[model samples]
Target: MMDLMEESRPDTPLALRGGTRSGDHEKITVNLGFVDLGHVDLLVSEGVYANRSDFIRTAIRNQIERHADITRQSVARNPIEVGLRRYGRAELESARAAGTRLDIRVLGLAVIADDVPADLASAAIASIEVLGSLQASPAVKRVLADRLL
Candidate 1:
């Protein structure tokens, strides 16, 4: 794993590159049981939350706060990228040209831009281990299927 403090780059701000949200956050889908859905609706109707998303976000934040220490330790140990990360064709091409390989480890989201080709991705990226989500073209995914974790 990379050292979190040493390898961290402030320039790489986490932003969902191609997501619907205008903010840096990425949109995600979650499935809930009927009872859980009803409870969320109840909370919204009772004015505890403006909407289901508000309640869910709050709940997730609370949970993360509750496990802050563990989360921090894990992040440090794994040295994974915490926000949104996007890789474009030019980036991959440059890596390939420089004979550099990528061992991608992301805790949030990692996206390979649509313009990137499968061969370029395969040549540049050696491995991938994403804890949250990965967004890549089908051909790229298939080419790197063995390297994904």
Candidate 2:
């Protein structure tokens, strides 16, 4: 049961602002198609993102920044967070070495491949900033909860 007042707050576990955190403020409204949104929504379903808005906001930002020659602002954007399942240990370690850990929060329930077990996910949890992955499966959730919730 979603509260009408929480229209802006989707029932997903994760949510992120469009740009880097700077205590900024801006607002705009535009309609996007369902097909495009479905693709983004898949990421949300896969436990890789928090909600529809997070995926759409990131997608729109990427599409806009793709025309970087004119905007000249792409250089400041954070690296993308897609393709999360394929990430290797070395890559995670490299990012962990950086002063600030990245956010890999997922929302709702999620299913990880059987081949990949909770132990591995447990290790990965240490390398992130916020680990709000409600989507993690029972076993994976148990492994990661110590670091996240």
Candidate 3:
């Protein structure tokens, strides 16, 4: 692939999947207050911290580490997936009884179980004779029919 960084503009969004590496650092410039500068200088002079940079770096690092897990989980659990994982054949029946729809997006080709099972899907398709609307692969339709049958 081309260099995404070169193509991306300054307004492009940046997401840290794994919170960045310790060795990979970027340069930044900041203004410091007189009191803060004096405190940093004193800390460096006392050998408690290497310098102001060290203190600031540690604070930024702590913030990143604190929010990394939250970021990863938030990325993983989608609204659609969340609803699907809690639904199945009986749930679909309940939904219909309550006058709700079971409309779905397959996302990709797969035989994995969730939302709608292969057996239920095949039954629905055969009953309605409209598997075309499901937009599922041919092989998957066979699997659904076979399992349901």
Candidate 4:
């Protein structure tokens, strides 16, 4: 994980602690109407965008920009890790050894490695608050379901 517990200190802005290029991007599926898809294709064909992905990225960026203030406020209010965060068995084991419990709050992707056992995850993680997405084995997901926000 990105260790937001330190970054979310009283004076720090959670959003400012992490870089934009955290190299953790989530793949999402969007259901668009046929007309919208056609319009996106048209934009790509007309050289407005390199491809559909480019067009959608631009559109999402614009929307995020429009609501930048609200996003910043929300990030400030919550202890959020703004980018991708992954936790593996080794990390959880270390946390367990150190008697540290994790209260994971992420705005982007949060992944618990497939190799991590459900019991270990339950012991190591205190809670999960993910705004975007979480990827984990079904067993771990079930164990943490009540703790997920």
lDDT of candidate 2 over 1-149, digit per residue (tens): 11111125344323343222222222233343456556666887998878765665566679967886644443235332322334344554555456434345332122344444565666545633222123334786576665653
Tens digit of lDDT per residue, candidate 1, span 27-84? 6445555566678789989999987767878898999899999989998887888888
Q: For this target, which candidate reaches the highest TM-score against the unseen true structure? A: 1
The RMSD (Cα, Å) of candidate 3 is 15.3
Candidates ranked, most accurate by TM-score first = 1, 4, 3, 2
Q: Better model by lDDT, 1 or 4?
A: 4
What are the models' TM-scores? 0.73, 0.29, 0.31, 0.71
Tens-digit lDDT track for model 3 on 1-149? 01101113333332122322232233343445556556767887999877556766777779969998874575477322221122345765565566654444222122223555554554333221221123344554565553331
Preferred candidate (TM-score higher): 3 or 4: 4
Which residue pairs of candidate 1 clash? none
Against the reference, the lDDT scores of all candidates come to: 0.78, 0.46, 0.44, 0.78
Candidate 2's TM-score? 0.29
Task: Compute the lDDT of residue 10 as modeled in candidate 2.
Answer: 45
What is the Cα-based lDDT of residue 60 in candidate 1?
84
Clashing pairs in 2: 13-107, 108-135, 109-135, 110-135
Error of 1 at 134 (Å): 1.6
